[model samples]
Target: MKKVTVTALSVVIGVGLLAGCTTKNESSDPAAAGNASNGTKPKVVTITVRENTWGARKDNFIEAQKRLNEDLKAKNVQVNIDWWPGIDDDELVLQATAGKVADVFMNSSVDIGWERDGGLIRDIDWVKDSSVFKGVPDSYTNIMKYDGHYYGVIQDMDASPVFISRKALTGLGWTGEQIDGLKDRVDKGDFIFSDLVNLADDAKKKKLVKMGFAVEDKRFEGWNYAFGFYNYDADQNKMVLSPKVKDVYAFWSDSVKRGVISEGIGDIDTDKAAPMFVKGEIFAEFARTEFYQMMREANGMKDDIEGYNKWFKDNVVWIPVPSAEKGGKPASYSNPAMIFVGSKVDDEKMPYVQQLIEHVMDPDLQINHTIASGKLPVTPAAQEDARFKAMDFYKDHAYLVSFTRTRPAHPDYATFVQGFTLGVDAILTKGKSSEEAYELFKKEVKQNVPADHVIIQ
Candidate 1:
């Protein structure tokens, strides 16, 4: 829970290293890189971090590295961070295979299975016993593990909920009370998925918006939303083509047929769809909390919870993903950003890597990051921390964690996701029935999923 000031340090060694080299060393003093006059040189350990340009992730790593250096200065060991921003997955895979991967990097929960399978990452089984990782829930850790070995520690948690445009609803003649009442209905299972379709259909018929609903164009994300809405079972540790899955396909197909969903929904990327939602061109869409922050920033609100809620309270409505049926469990999808040590890291550097992991996992530091980034905390301790509970944002949105579920953590999870997306696409775009699509999905899963990974029942 130690805190550090955000000082801009020259963390990048040189621009030339970005062309596929594996080292970038940042030191407090430039001359410290050379041996001291006493014939003793400090050991420099370079920790490479790969992340996208979103959120405060890059800053978090830099600050953590600074703290790490402060902690290790007494031991005569200094840690340098090589920051790689905006590196895509394909490039990361190439780097990893060529033995040029970063020592510690950020990755999605879905990548854990494949990365472990490819032997691109190390197994940090000792993390569970560490004090820094003490209160992290198994639900988060399970998603970052392959088989029974821990490969990463969750950096942040997030949930995807349906965001509604209040202007669109009010334009459709709904009163403020009515709009406010929608959240209660959604929570109590009174506002089912079919109800969403009906509302969107009415809005479309009345021409309240050009599209009644929109979803991310990525098939995997869309399927994840559907999986949550349908309450697809994950406890069984196997992919079961549940009969309930048909309801999900039917909903998409029906919405498309009714012309309530965007025709270009399959092609509408987040950047394109976000503006449409803000302008009231779309009534409702499934999106994450980060998107809410983006909208607030776009509207010129100050970057704080008060500013966000002031605008959200008046202009937008947030609700959980509706259940498939009334009185059923409402659910939503969540995924965690994780940090992993690469397979190529030397044994001599493992302890230092653990120290860096521990520094970032501090509950106070995590709460601060959560406040700045709009991501949920990874540990129960952080969620229950005094600072977290005092924030208006946490007070309002913490209820979402109750209904959030991560995708199944099976070793073939990636394959299952791809197959599910393809099957859903077939039902929506092709002239295929739900039965045919399910059959094709089952065939794909069986053919690709390893036999040992499959679970009966």
Candidate 2:
């Protein structure tokens, strides 16, 4: 859910090294060689976009603008984005809501999801007639829909969240069985907290794994999403937090007892967790393909990444988190970023918004996007990109992105997740019982989730 800059992070990791290292866009440099080569600034449109928090600079904005400028130039339009990532996301959201911020902001669909309920955001569906929006899908349109209205544009769609073995599944004792065969024994297609205990015991006997499993029980994701539990049933209007809540905590604790998983699993975010896998301690973990690095960077593990790929060329299997019931489909969730347009702006600005969103949907852009960011693409054809075809991570495990359920679209979503995580962490760390933590969290959520709103079953 971080509205991060792939470009800045790219620079952080030294990706896509821009051709020349020119200091600036002076007439003397070739990196800026294309600056004066284009047509007159098509009205020099100034569009404000939030800056990325990852050390991204105004010049980085200039660079993205430079590329976007080129794209705009091709279509004979002039434009600019005001990059503005800050240290505080909530404060920025407040600023934007108060009309003191940028024109466009990158946030989980919750922004427009809130907007869709009323004047929260403008309905931009009227712009579909614009040439910029030729082939985008209705699925993309559905993301912006709320209460029968479409108000935002969805930029990217990743797979529902998934848990992965740091190594392969066979390492967890799935040997001699096909993926489908392995799928049957796990109740309801769900792998419960207890199943992992037995598996870990088996692995220990075989010296196959260091721990049973890893659980970020309090992760914004893992908290509300532990399988075997029923979340808010909007239609039913009942709260059943404990269905899988106890096991969520139990899974972490038992994993801790088994000693197969990392003790500090849930303490840190992906940045820290990834390294544990790199250290070759944990057998598997949950993450998107973008994190294959942690495993690739194992100490003294050479560029065997190229070699690993050649070997698993078509064997990297992706699977969902096991559910509590055997034969039950495991569910994973992914937060989506919604693209919104300012309703207060004149009708003329509508086309511009369409152009921006449409540009996002551009086939070439999506191809490069999937290549640059390990996030899954919503466009089916985009998956055929040579870059995607070359990636080993997606070879067999590709469908991990196919089964995702969209995250809730409420303004309080983030805070609710934060509260849930803290409560769960207390259950895992402070020895607070799950019932105690869940009770505290339920009260907090009831106070916040609105009286009329429903919590899923």
Q: Scored by Cα lDDT, where does model 1 land?
A: 0.68
What would the per-residue lDDT of candidate 1 be over residues 217-297, giving only the tens digit for each residue? 453343435444322345555555455566666666777788886445767666677777777778787766666766766
Q: Give lDDT per model, in order.
A: 0.68, 0.50
In Å, residue 317's CA in model 1 sits off its true spot by 0.8
Per-residue lDDT of model 2, residues 388-408, tens digit only:
677756534455544555555
The residue ranges of model 2 lying beyond 4 angstroms of the native Cα positions read 1-44, 52-77, 80-87, 113-121, 126-142, 160-194, 204-208, 220-263, 297-305, 308-317, 430-434, 447-449, 454-457
Per-residue error (Å), model 1, residue 142: 2.0
Error of model 1, residue 18, in angstroms = 9.0
RMSD of each: 7.2, 8.3
Model 2: residue 446 alpha-carbon error in angstroms:
3.8
